[model samples]
Target: MYILQTVVVKQVLTEKMKRQLLLSYEEQKSQLQREYEQLRFEQKKAEKKYKNSKKESAQLYEKEMQKRLDKIQNIEFQVNQLSLLPLGSELKEQELQTMTEVNVGDRWSDIENEKTIIIKDGIIIDIR
Candidate 1:
């Protein structure tokens, strides 16, 4: 009877140890699963943030390029205006001596009375 009791107690202890070990393993697995879920959430958030930053960067770059293009167009227009001025001046100088003198009591001719001149789009016009 003493031997039989000892064996029964040993079997109970072994079963308790197995149950505890199984519970410990389950707890560890649950904790690791939670950690993995948290890591996945953080990664998703980081990816969204990165994508937003990239889009903003691209928009900024496009705006900068547009501004540069506008500036270049303005400079080109100014250069074209500057280039036409000398040619207009040379033409006006050639015509200076050919202008006929008109008296105050003349026939009021349209060609002789025109004085104010304007140049636009490379065309010269006389404005009275």
Candidate 2:
């Protein structure tokens, strides 16, 4: 029989990877800022269209804008934290599901422990 199991993928952080991650975070923050601006514009437009219920429209749009602001702040915090980590540190990149063949005598304990794949410099370095 075959069953699906989760596997963890970890990346060994190098200088290059660190820079790339920082760049990615910056890009995300910038995108969120753009969305926030767009939201503000929309809120203003809504207020003009619904003068009688401007307060309600403003409140709704403010809520959505706050969400984007929070996301931008989170990305900034992550960037700060990532900067402090030392090189060669293992970071959990992602998780993937794989099919595993099982027999009647398969050891449950071993199967229960998910496998980890370690990558360094874009190459697979180890599997544990």
Candidate 3:
């Protein structure tokens, strides 16, 4: 009878040890799952921050490029205005008269004859 009692006690102790070991394993697994979820949340936040920064950078670049284009356009407009003015030291009043007075309805042949006469006289004449 004593031997039987000892066997039952040993079996009970073995079963208790198995239950404790299973509970410890489950706790470890639960802790690891929580850590994994936290890491995923942190990664998502970081990605969002990076995307926002990239968008802001692109907008700034666009604004800077537009400013440069506007500056160039203004400079080009000023250059064009400067080009329309007359050049050289001679003014309009200083120009020599090179044409003889001709009335309206003058024939082309008459203009040609006048040009020949002026050429022979060694004087340059311009007829329109």
Candidate 4:
């Protein structure tokens, strides 16, 4: 499904907001790091536990290990994308779809989403 994300206003970013966003990003990145470490530890633990278990238990733990690996991959992707947030940029994401009508705006897109569009004066602005 397509979701409308990332709204940016022209020249509204302030130093204080930028600092706050940086701090928030730092915290989130650190949290992700900690989660990644925990996942690694759990994967190792599972490996050791299943190393000598019966065939059935080995299969079960192998599935569990795969799940952990997938979760780790997802978290890593999120962590990497965290750095790309428009924290200090001119654009901020439109968190809600309350903007039913706009006069003129621009449109752009990213890797997963399409078209950052701005509408103003009943006209669509393609900013991408």
Candidate 5:
């Protein structure tokens, strides 16, 4: 029989990989900052256009703006942590669903233990 299994993909942080990750994080921060600015602009415009409903409109826009600001802060923290970590640190990158074949007598422990894939410099280095 075959079943779908969750596999973990980990990345080994080399210098190149670290730089790439930092760049990606910076890009995310920039986009979020833009979004935050846009939200502020919209909120001000809304307040100017609708004096009677200014409080409600401002609250709604503030909530969305806060979400974006929180994300930017999180990404900033990740960037700082990543910069402090040394090379060869392992980071859990993502998870993937894969098809696996199972026999009647297969050991569940073994199958579960072998679900991690390690990547370095964009290439897979190990599966364990």
Candidate 6:
């Protein structure tokens, strides 16, 4: 009885830890997405300002706009990379699984990204 109780307690703790891990990953991903959105907004603002600028100011604003573009691109890349995690994934990896049994609607998520593999007739048909 004591052993069974301990086992149940251990399983509960394990599940709780898994939930925490999932939450942490979600938080990180959310942060990245928020940053990406903010960067995009800033870029838009910069573009508008650039458009309204005079010749010399336009050249300066153009430089600033280019820098903003690079920053936005970097943030987008970060967000894309963080999109995969314990919460959900849709990325397709190079590793092949030995187990072949799967239904048409069965979905397997990537460990690193928001990519999911679509299985059709016991084979992986697409990754989305």
Q: Which window of ten consecutive residues has the lowest lDDT sum in model 4?
A: 95-104
State the lDDT of candidate 4 residue by residue for 33-85, as single tens digits: 67656756765676777776546665664676566567656656755665565
Candidate 2 accuracy as lDDT: 0.94
TM-score of 1: 0.30
- For residues 3-121, could you state the per-residue lDDT of candidate 3 as single tens digits? 11100111111334334534655565555555545545554565677785765555554565555456555545544543453332111112232344455776646544422111112
RMSD of 6: 17.0
Candidate order by decreasing lDDT:
2, 5, 4, 6, 1, 3
Runs in model 5 with CA error above 4 Å?
A: none
Off by over 4 Å in 3: 1-13, 52-128
Number of clashes in every candidate structure?
A: 0, 0, 0, 22, 0, 8
Flag the better candidate by TM-score, 5 or 6: 5
**Residue pairs clashing, model 2:** none
Give Cα-based local distance difference scores for all models.
0.44, 0.94, 0.41, 0.52, 0.91, 0.46
Provide TM-scores for the models: 0.30, 0.92, 0.30, 0.42, 0.91, 0.32
Q: Which wins on TM-score, candidate 3 or candidate 6?
A: 6
Number of the candidate with higher lDDT, 3 or 6: 6
User: Among all windows of ten consecutive residues in candidate 3, which has the lowest summed lDDT?
Assistant: 1-10
lDDT of 6 by residue, 70-98 (tens): 66566556555554444323333234333
Between prediction 4 and prediction 6, which has the larger lDDT? 4
Q: Which candidate order results from sorting by TM-score in descending order?
A: 2, 5, 4, 6, 1, 3
Best by TM-score: 2
Best of the two (2, 6) by lDDT: 2
